[model samples]
Target chain A: MKVLEQFEFLDDVRRMDARQVIYQFLNFCMIVASALMIWKGLMVITESESPIVVVLSGSMEPAFYRGDLLLLTNHHDEPIRAGEIVVFKIKGRDIPIVHRVIKLHEKEDGTTKFLTKGDNNRVDDRGLYAPGQLWLKREDVVGRARGFLPYVGIVTILMNDYPQLKYAVLGCLGIYVLIHRETN
Target chain B: MAVLTFMCFLSTYYNDDLADVNIKVGSVQVKNVADFTTTRERKDLAIINNLGVKVDLSQVFNWNVKEIFLYLTAEYSSDVNALNQVVLWDKIVMREDAQRIDIPSVDPEYYFFDDSKGLIGNENVTLTLSWNVIPNAGRLPRVQGLGSTTVKLPSTYAHSSGRI
Candidate 1:
């Protein structure tokens, strides 16, 4: 009986005003909703499943490096061309590759066949392709390069390279934001 | 409340933006070139002797020496008659060593293609060169590199010399 009474007393002290708690929860929900909306908006505008990507390798060096952020847009009407850099995912490979289109071979049936070569390597990317898959079709492309920023993705690389650091940073930020909430 | 939410969103976005790096593709130049043409007897199909190829290294940059492994490979379409024929048509043709420079010099004579057996037909050929650039090696983590162009054959036609 005594323990139950103490528990009730602690719960009462910990309970925030209903209005204030509702306000905070609603704000958090709004932020989440807005983020979702923005992502959906990008998907619609770019006509791509993924509008943003990070460079995972140095295959496209001098143009894009590891940790660099890339903006992509895939409009089906826009034909893939030689000399343009692209991000594409190969079968069985989890990460996508960024390389330049060195050759374009169009089949008689209106299907496009293409070859990619890294800007930094000596030859084309046939070795990177799946076994016996000599060419990449239009369906394999994620997006064409629209624009990019330099070295800004290093923090992502650091976080990924050291997951503990990421959790610690996130925890600290969450605590700081909660504890330092403005009373006004 | 709205202001707080906006601030939180902005902070998250800013944090996300700061985590990644950016790299750009600049000019690409051919630094090295190799040609492989061979003829062989195949019971399945007739081979063509007019097989000609060009392998070129365009450019490389922003590489970490420690994180990459550089290898040069050539893959061709398997429809050619000389799929496994070994022919010593040419002696040592071209040889080039990898170097650390803005533009590495690649001699075209150290590499050669043997065409003694028979020429492979309709096979798409591919060549690859890969290398890892070490990070924090005092040198800039980024690099702009080049490769060589194909050497002209006696009977082969020349189209602009493949110069970058």
Candidate 2:
């Protein structure tokens, strides 16, 4: 019965006036564009390429659990210090690792080389880095964690873990928007 | 939830005081060891002896703070590197654990490895205590303690066969 109802909704879309269909399409586009604009604005304000990240591993346990949301800011003027949590990307690795800066060496020319370690792990992140990479330079750092929100990123994790649920949610939202009646 | 987090941040944002913390370095033993982790060259290894730390961090904890990551670092300047900061010891203070940290003598948790021979006879090596407050939902503020101590490494290095 639910499948038949959804098929009837598809028929309703076909029967709609061409002008009305265009208006609905334009509304959807407007929503997506505004979301993109907001994201870009945040990137500009924070000075970070990716301003937000979700904790995906338990290496930083007791402080940052899985599915926690983290706000990051990367300022070129700010020097990375010890004990500061940073999100860095290794060469050839797609996923960025979030760890705490434990050791740092700064040269006279203002270049800094540092080492990172997870809180729960016994050793530093040398094994996690690319082969022959002894130290992480300033360019490797993505951003420094500024703020945190717990358990708010569970929705994103769930969608990534279950593709069927993602499709179902997207399909339902699309259908609802298409059939939505404007009172104005 | 957003409002609550904002309110929590506002309440503790101005409270920057980390309370009184005392750190002392008794005797530092410096040795040269082969560096397999990084460059194949020999590295200066400094082992701290009779390290004493006492701090009452009970007042540092607020409702928003979940835990505190305490670390002791050795900061020095050398010809090899203008500035070198190596963490010698660290501890995690949970909300349920006693916040009053008092230790007369303790073993160093991590090795103090320098890329070059910076730790040998370094006269201006300063050991400072710093902490990062892990909040339930707010900014992660890193505040350094008020007190620190200096240690001078011996001019000669210890034997490599000595127990680390």
User: Quick one: best lDDT, which candidate?
Assistant: 2
Model 1, runs deviating above 4 Å: A1-16, A177-183, B1-164
Residue A125 of model 1 has an lDDT of 84
On residues B7-103, what C-alpha lDDT tens digit does candidate 2 reach at each position?
A: 9878888888477889877777899887666886788988888999998899999898999999998899998889999888899999999999999
The whole-model C-alpha lDDT of candidate 1 against the native structure comes to 0.48
Interface RMSD of 1: 12.2
lDDT of 2 by residue, A58-148 (tens): 9999899999999999999999988899999999999999999999999999899999999999999999999989899999999899999
Chain A TM per prediction: 0.84, 0.90
> What's the residue-level lDDT of A1 in candidate 2?
48
- The sequence of per-residue lDDT tens digits that candidate 1 reaches over residues A1-184 is 5675566534432454767656655665676689899999998999887887788888766545788777788999887754456789999998888886654544344466777777667667888899878778899998876655556678888999999999999877654433333457
**What's the distance in Å from true for residue A141, model 2?**
1.0
DockQ of 1: 0.05
What's the CA error at residue B77 for candidate 1, in Å? 21
Candidate number with greatest TM-score: 2
TM-score of each: 0.51, 0.92
